[model samples]
Target: MSEAMRKPETNGAPPVISVRGIDMVFLKKAPGVLDGLARRAGLPRPEPVGVHALDGVDLDVMKGEVVGLVGESGCGKSTLGRVIAGILDPTAGTFRFHGREMSEMSPQERYRAKVAVQMIFQDPFASLNPRKRVIDIIGEAPVVHGIVPKAEISDYVDEIMLKCGIDPAFKQRFPHQFSGGQRQRIGIARALAVKPQFLVCDESVAALDVSIQAQVINLFMDLRRDFDLTYLFISHDLGVVEHIADRVVIMYLGRVVETAPTAELYANPRHPYTQALLANMPRISTEKQAFGQIKGEIPSPLNPPSGCHFHPRCPFAFDRCVAERPRLITKAPGIAAACHLLEEAAR
Candidate 1:
């Protein structure tokens, strides 16, 4: 298989973007006087807890590769995406762009890095400015960054809009005047205007209809082919991930539990979390795909279970699973999984 089709982890080339030991914690503030009033009025009171959004996540994105990031809601998929796009800085850990530490980069270097890595947000309605015309939204950035002269902005905007399947005629319309799919295309065009080499697509198609989703996905494939862009596609839909990704990264409770070439991971998932997620996804064939029941609710991240975060819900939990967290270790060529029982499973 071509290097682009294989697991990117096995590639000797240094990653275009590398993330190491990323940990993010959100402090849920204590209840204010409103909480006391609510309690007095027999209303439910909010509990304060430090929500751990991500936990020691390590990931790498090779140039010219699409890596799917999948996990349940609140599992930190979006957080990781934002961190990679420089939208949010990790509370702890290191992010490197082209072998240089992101946090240590000079202001000029940082601006260049941020422009090179752009994000496509999920909700088009909220992401696009309702009041501004589409032309301004997409054209202003490139002109401000000196990517194009003001006199040429019109042609440049039209070119980008056309590439993303948006009509150049609609450039004068506001975001609210466009349909959901058109709005999303506008968002894509805006990202493309920045001349980004990497894109962090955080559930970029989840809100669109199934048919629209397919069209957008195909558009992404076409764009990738044309520009050699790298994508970090984050989604909860395994089906979509299966179709769009060359490699898949499975995260749980802010930590990556498994990563492998798309087909291999789906066929032979080592981590129990990955197994359960795959089993839950609807399949067209009736070949009995149930791996095992993933019992128990996902424990609260505020005070997650000791040792492995997934241990409480894992079917094969043992003393070690409850005492020490397992690192994501290589299991085979082009495959890696975080599970203490990998050796036993191999045997």
Candidate 2:
């Protein structure tokens, strides 16, 4: 088999999806001209700052592998996912699927690329249309893309609905008629309608109850096996990622702090940010151990701290961390971390 068709192994095929140096910036609306003029006359700058949603973020997802993206709220996990799905264009970056540049693709080409990459949003209720029936919702993609004839739309929708663990009869029901978990299942069915090769699940299970969360997660696992799907699973819940992710990426303040195999990351986190994140996870153990406590609120993206963005909260931060930004360097085989401390450790 060709490299692109091969499944993920320890050191196997190149990434099916590759994102490099992605930077997404949102321009904040400036204040009135009068305010700006006043600011120019020996006052604070009145010009609106640019919000850096993603700052030079890099990631790779191999075919048929589940990669987890974990971070605090507003840490750019969802923004990255949207970029990968081609729903939101990045301010500056390269996104490639099967070695083809996603940004340069034509409309038809982009549509085809989108067919291969799909997204499952966080809020089930918000994702689905209130007026549309479940059948229509799931079949909309295939119909627009001409994947199936109008006569066969219902049949195709029924097949995927069943595959996603939803009853065929439930297709006629509106989204409001269903519970949170069921609504999520319907959303999954919609994404599956296109028979995507890659899935970007943005907090897919966060809204459901604990028991229901497991069921939804299991459905995702089963669907992956049955459909040969690769996923970019984004979540704030480290526990859920531990259960499903093959590799995990830790994000803080719009940049990746660390990336490692699931077991390796949980076992030994190199970056102080990663260490602090893992240390705070809820656990039952009463044993005394050194735990790094996260301090201070995340700085606003519009005016983020210079040098190391995490320096304000990182206990191990030093003068160099405040003066120079760190690049992600491979600290171990298949594990990379962005921290000045690692350079000393490596030497």
Candidate 3:
């Protein structure tokens, strides 16, 4: 087993971060009465309804655990990460940090939460300021927040750069001067400078090369162990998630479809969506799949199919799947599935 898979388990500890039935609905702007005219003129047309970016997401991250959030693009994995990091408030449902209700926190408690939860974005170069030098980019936060004295900022930044595997000599250089991997390291260093307890990594390695991806993932594991950090690692790459995640959460069209411990989910996926995803992967093992690929593209969230959101694409979907939504229910130990056909599949 990989070292990442060997990390200590939380074992049902109280959650450091918790979310229940959180809904993040975004109002996609409409183009007004010009819809027909715009279409005729080959211009952009209006949307009829709001985008359901996240619909009734429930998740919990125990302290020191790395929970991987996996799905295709536009599946709300990144939005869910943002919600957990406090970058975006949910439209509905409860969010608690260290057992304290997010909405009910005092001013100081809110500030602490804000600093404790940090986000490392997908595009490292785009996230970094072009004009700022590496030193200011990483050291400014701690200095301004009184975590590090102004006089010690340079040394502090140097220490951080070393920790993140960046050369201190590049402290004076801008983000553009560094390679993609180095820029990502700088981004990681910047997040660490704030002394965050939790990290929401939104496709943090998606832009890197295959070799670089492994290196960055290894670095994340090292840092997680060193800092005792908890993470909501969001990415579309199931291969990466399989390698690093202790627990995996799968989402489809703004809602969670399945969740399970890494080994069990990969060994036997309960949801058809999860099965399709696994089937689509390039399997180099001895096993051969009897089924073909999942058909069609994902339905637009603005008009997601009623009942089970995944029913439209599911092969085994029956009448019940088209009439009523399936709630997330436990199917086995450390496994939960949100599909009407789960029990039927088991039998």
Score each candidate by Cα lDDT: 0.88, 0.89, 0.89
Clashes of each: 0, 0, 0
Worst 10 residues of 2 by lDDT: 1-10
- The digit string of per-residue lDDT tens for model 1 on 1-347 reads 35544434435667889999998878788568898799899988666577889999988888888999999977899999998998887889998887788769999998998899999999999999888999999999999999999999999999999999988998999999888998999999999998998999999999999899989998998898787789999999999999889889999888899999999999989899998998888878859776446777877667778888898888889999999988888977669998889855666
C-alpha positional error of residue 332 in candidate 2 after TM-score superposition, expressed in Å = 2.3
Runs of candidate 3 with Cα error greater than 4 angstroms are 1-13, 30-48, 283-292, 345-347
Q: State which candidate, 1 or 3, has the greater TM-score.
A: 3
Per-residue lDDT tens digits for candidate 3, residues 212-256, read 988899899889877888888998999999988889999999999
Q: Candidate 1, which segments miss by more than 4 Å at Cα?
A: 1-12, 29-49, 285-292, 343-347
Predict model 3's lDDT versus the native.
0.89
